[model samples]
Target: MNSRKQVASSFTSATQIPISKEILETPVVTTIVSSSDEEEEMSFEADLWVSLTKTGKQKTPNMIRNDLQKYIDECKENGTSSQAKIVKSLAVDNDSFRKFMNPKNYPDQWSATKNETYWAATKLLEKVKHEKKSTKVATVSSARSKRKTSDSPCISQKKTKSELRSDLKALIARVHAVPNVAQNGGVYDSCTEVVAKIKKFLNRDGMTKALFLEAVLGGVNPHILAKFLAGKKQDQCETIVYRTAYVFFEKLRILEGRKKSKARNINEERYPQGFSLTKK
Candidate 1:
């Protein structure tokens, strides 16, 4: 039994491969960084971009306009006055304040109703606020909701710090169980498949709030584990898994060792992609 334990310990030690500086310094995946339910997991901003890119040239301005209009109308109908959410959803370009404000882009700049929404969104977003963000951040809200702010319909909400740690602890455990990133590709391939599946699901069904919070909070979506860590810091162990989790929606594909582009421009994304855990 002692020998067996020794063997297991050796195996575990062997698996703890040194992470290359190249890996951590790898060029971040580029993304238009930007939430969920069982019927509605992943982020709406990420989902929107997914649908748009998939449609390709086939997606006309009118189609985008209609979609934007529908989203705006729905928010107002639901009495949701979350300017932050609305702004984030509409403005995807990291630097362009008017990315979604133009008539050529999507929203009708001439119309009062749409223009109101557009200006409000822009005013809420501080310039350079997204500078530090990266590609992995495009999808997902925070793991926990803020106390029912004035905008929140709920009367109040709370979660102890212990609960947050417990949840993160479980998620890190699952990430470790996945193939090690230090070995070959890690969970990058699996990550891609899951993200594609999520994009397809959202595009096919369109938007539905009936199950949004549940998916965002993880009643049905496994991606929430990744989602929760979006745009957040990571420790040593969590960093390993963050690399794989980030692969799901990263736009920046280059790493530090790769050839850097001369004409390449960098933009800040809202969500985080890479992850790591500090403790054993």
Candidate 2:
């Protein structure tokens, strides 16, 4: 036994012997690292000119009218007959005048020539207003033609409390069916087929309000999942689904928080070496 122990110790020492520094040292090899050098050439040139041409067109009636009117008014004050010449030159004919007055026909002029045209048209409209004011006219009261509350029999109609309660109960029952259908991802498909069948049933019944409500609430139509779910009572269904989904989401959030807390506690207790959670 002592001899066997001696042989084992010798084997262990031989295997565990440290490597020499010379054997561990790696040879240095000269390696040429090559990279291409590139340069971007850039050039810029600018040219400019000045001229006496007008920057924008003077096409607006308001602008033309204002300038024309100002010139005419100045001529009038100076006791010159140039007003008649300007009017003759600028005044559109009755046919063209009507078209020009239309905003659609003269969009640019309408917008840009507002101030100028307003003054010009004001003068013209004053003449028209004066003419109209001079003429006598009869007036009629529109209130006499309006219908009174007493004329309509249905205006005072009210729904009964029993009717409202019945509607609510029916809607609740319909909502309960949604969860069963929605379970196992079959709700959308079931609702679609149901809606289509319901539509056909309603159409056969001549599209009455009762039929519409029944079809929508019962999910008795044959349509796409989106369309099937989109019922008259969809708002109510959405409310229920939203509440349920929100509850689920809240529970999930709480579970996640708990898991994180537990993980953090475990990490704090262990503090294992070389087991860092922080990214390098």
On TM-score, the leading prediction is 1
Q: Each model's TM-score?
A: 0.28, 0.16
Q: Where is model 2 poorest over a 10-residue stretch in terms of lDDT?
A: 40-49
Stretch of 10 with least lDDT, candidate 1: 262-271
Candidate 1 Cα deviation (angstroms), residue 158: 26
What are the lDDT figures for the candidates, one per model?
Answer: 0.34, 0.33
Model 2 score (lDDT) = 0.33
> lDDT of candidate 1 vs native?
0.34
Q: Write the per-residue lDDT of candidate 1 for residues 1-280, one digit (tens) a residue.
A: 2322342244334335675544422212223222111122222222112122332222223344455556557768888745346656544343343444355553322222223333223222321123224223533233223332545776555556566546544543454444423432322222322343334433422323223223222243545444533422122234333343343222122221233221111111221332113342
Instruction: List, residue by residue over 78-153, the lDDT tens digit for candidate 2.
Output: 7865645544443434454344345565433333222233323433433333345434221122233234334765
